[model samples]
Target: MIKWILILLVVAAVASLLGYHTLAGAAATGARILIGIVLVIFLLVLFGLFAVT
Candidate 1:
């Protein structure tokens, strides 16, 4: 999931550099959404680990 996000981010950067505004925006949005989901899951896991300890 994180790898996908990174890939999408790179795609976004390259698209932006090539002036593909629509593709860049879509890829950027995908990366942002994936990052948010990963962050939320990470926080939940961290809290669960602390709670168990």
Candidate 2:
């Protein structure tokens, strides 16, 4: 998941450099959403609301 976020960010950067504004925006949005999801999951685990074996 973290890897995906990184990949998306790279893609966004490249797209922006190439002047593909729409693609860049989409990739950036995807990265932002994944970051939010990861943050929420991390918080849940930290507070013991989620269990891991």
Candidate 3:
């Protein structure tokens, strides 16, 4: 799950960057949102892991 979240976060970040910087359009909004969600999930996982350790 953590790995999945990390992968998603990386994908989202890249997608958002590409969509906005390269493509440029409303499509970028979706990518940005995905990036935010993935980042939140990634942070949650990190927090959970820290708590466990």
lDDT of 2 by residue, 1-53 (tens): 99999999999999999999999999999999999999999998887854554
Weakest ten-residue segment in model 1 by summed lDDT = 2-11
- Ten residues in a row with the worst lDDT in model 3? 20-29
What tens digits encode model 1's per-residue C-alpha lDDT throughout 1-53?
98999999999999999999999999999999999999999999999999999
- What lDDT, from 0 to 1, does candidate 3 have? 0.63
Cα-based lDDT at residue 38, candidate 1 = 97
Model 3 residue 51 distance off true place after TM-score fit, in angstroms: 0.1
- TM-score of every model versus the real structure: 0.96, 0.90, 0.54
Winner by TM-score: 1
Error of 1 at 16 (Å): 0.4
Per-residue C-alpha lDDT of model 3 across residues 1-53, encoded as one tens digit per residue: 44554565566567667765433434345556666787898999999999999
What TM value does model 2 have? 0.90
Q: List the residue pairs that clash in candidate 2.
A: none
Q: Each model's C-alpha lDDT?
A: 0.98, 0.96, 0.63
- Report, for all candidates in order, the number of backbone clashes: 0, 0, 0
